[model samples]
Target: MAGLVDALGPILELMTWVGFVPGVPLLVWGLIIARRRCVWTRTTGEVYSAGGFTGFRWTDQDNVQRQTLVDADVARGLVAGNEVELHYDLCHPARWALGRPKHDNTVLILGWILTSVGILCTVGGFVLLLF
Candidate 1:
C-alpha cells in the first residue's frame, strides 16, 4: 500500500502540473479580451472582402487613422463608409482590430476554470511532495 501510494503521488503530481500549465496563458488572454475597449467609428475607406475576410480603414480615439478587419459574419453586413465599433486591446494598440461580440458569461467561465486548474495543480503538487 505504501508503494502504491508513492507511485500514485508522482502520477497525480504530473497530472496536476499538466492541468495547471495552461491556466496562466488562458487567464492572461481572457483578461486581455475582457478589458478591451470598443469604440464606434465610421469607415473612411472602401471595405474590401477577400478570402472570407474584410478590411477597411477608420479613425479611432485621439483622431488617429487606423485600419481594421473582421471575419465573414461581421463583415457581411458592413459596407464602405459605414459606422462600426471596434473592439481593441488597449495594451496592444498596434493590433487594433475587430473581435467577437462581448459575452458577459465568458469572462466568469474562463476565470473560474483557469483559477480552479491552477489551484488544483499547485495543491496537488504540494500533496505529492508530502507523500
Candidate 2:
C-alpha cells in the first residue's frame, strides 16, 4: 500500500545509513589491532595447539620457555627448534606478534566520515518522521 511504502522509506534509509556508519570504525579498529607491534624472540618455534587455538612455544637464551599465539601466516612453514623472532606488545604480553601488519590512516579517516554521515542521516530521518 502507498501508506506503508511511505512510512517504510525513511526507516529503510535510516537503517542503511546506520548499518554503514559503524562499519568504518569496525574496520579501523580491526586494522589498528592487527597492525599494533608485538614482541617475539629471534628463534623459530614449533606450533602447538592450546585453548583450541594454535600457538608457538620456544625457549629463550636464558633457558626460559615462552609460549604465544601466532597468526596463520607465521604458523605456516614453521618448524620446531627453528629460529624465529617473536613480536609482542610491550604493554600486553599476553598478545603475541605474528608479522608486521600494514598501517594506514585512511581507515581511521573513513571511520570519522562515516560516523558523521550516519549522524546526519539519523537526525534527518528523525526530523522527517516528526513532520
Say which candidate scores most in TM-score. 1
Tens digits of per-residue lDDT for model 1 on 23-56? 5566677778766744433223456665656776
Going through the candidates in the order shown, the clash numbers are 0, 16
Q: What are the RMSDs of all candidates, in order? A: 8.0, 9.4
Q: Highest lDDT among the candidates is held by which one?
A: 2
- The C-alpha stretches of model 1 lying farther than 4 A from their native spots are 37-111
- Deviation in angstroms for 110 in model 2? 3.7
- Full-model lDDT for every candidate: 0.61, 0.62
Candidate 2 lDDT over residue span 1-131, tens digit each: 66875786677587657756685666678578657745443554566766655677766556667787667766677654555566544445455555643445566666666766766666666666755
